[model samples]
Target: MNEKTVAGYCIRCNDQGYLTDLEQWNREIGLEIAEEENITMTDKHWEVIEYLQNQCKQGVAITIRKVGKSGVVDIKQFYQLFPNGPLKKASKIAGIPKPVSCI
Candidate 1:
């Protein structure tokens, strides 16, 4: 697969532009991705992002309902935090792939 560049970093991205090389993720890349998504990273947004990153590291599968149940934030708040396609966008911004339950 072809890799792309963002913020001067080589990135392997999917059709929707999520990182395929999880190890290549960094704060700079996350910020660039978030900017591309039109999201301003706030504390609440960080909460969910951190949660997803931690879960991903633990090999946990994330979902809207699972995030809601995780107590980091509820489903409505998750959508509010990442509007539109919350799980997909959040996972992408967190430098993880789209969740299986997402599509």
Candidate 2:
């Protein structure tokens, strides 16, 4: 019999950190949340993150209004389309640093 080895993504670096990687300071629970629920990470996700990061660099929240500039829907729609919160799983896959708020 073989046991299943679960692999998870790190919330901080988005690297595949497994059970041996679990630590207290900056580890995110719900391993499945990090492992599954990853979108295809299309240009759309990139566009969204780029806009959000730019706005964040300016000390502003990336709102639907800003997302509108990309012709994308609100965060709610993003979640609906992506099936997970913006900064939790998808953002990690999209290659954006985990938002401080999400930590």
Candidate 3:
């Protein structure tokens, strides 16, 4: 298993840069990822991030349309939150792999 550091802790990540071990995730790590993405974490952002993480854990496909139906936020709002590519960036911040539909 490949290892990467986050919040000063060595953790595992997949080839595409998503955290391989969800157990290694934490708010500080998420904040660092959000910062790297040039996004400031807000309550709304946390809600969306957590939602996406949950979706990932459930093995559900994630997309703008799917998130819109989640009632957490509509597609437009998702864009406003994550700016340059909502699903992709948000998933990254959530420590979930880039969804298959992302690319």
Tell me the TM-score of each prediction against the true structure.
Answer: 0.89, 0.42, 0.89
Candidate 1 vs candidate 3: which has greater lDDT? 1
Residue 48 shift from truth in candidate 3, angstroms = 0.3
Worst 10 residues of 3 by lDDT: 94-103
Instruction: Write candidate 3's Cα lDDT for 1-103 as tens digits.
Output: 6788878878788866678778789989999888888999899999998898898889888878889999899999999999988888898888887877435
Per-residue error for 18 in candidate 2, Å, reads 16
Name the lDDT of candidate 2: 0.46
- Candidate 1's C-alpha runs over 4 A off are 101-103
lDDT for 76 (candidate 3): 90
Best by lDDT: 1
lDDT of 2 by residue, 1-103 (tens): 1223334333333243322222221212332444465545555655664555455556665444456555656667677656745544544433333445654
Error of 2 at 74 (Å): 2.8
* Order by lDDT, highest first: 1, 3, 2
Cα error, residue 100 of model 2, in Å, equals: 5.5
Q: List the residue pairs that clash in candidate 3.
A: none
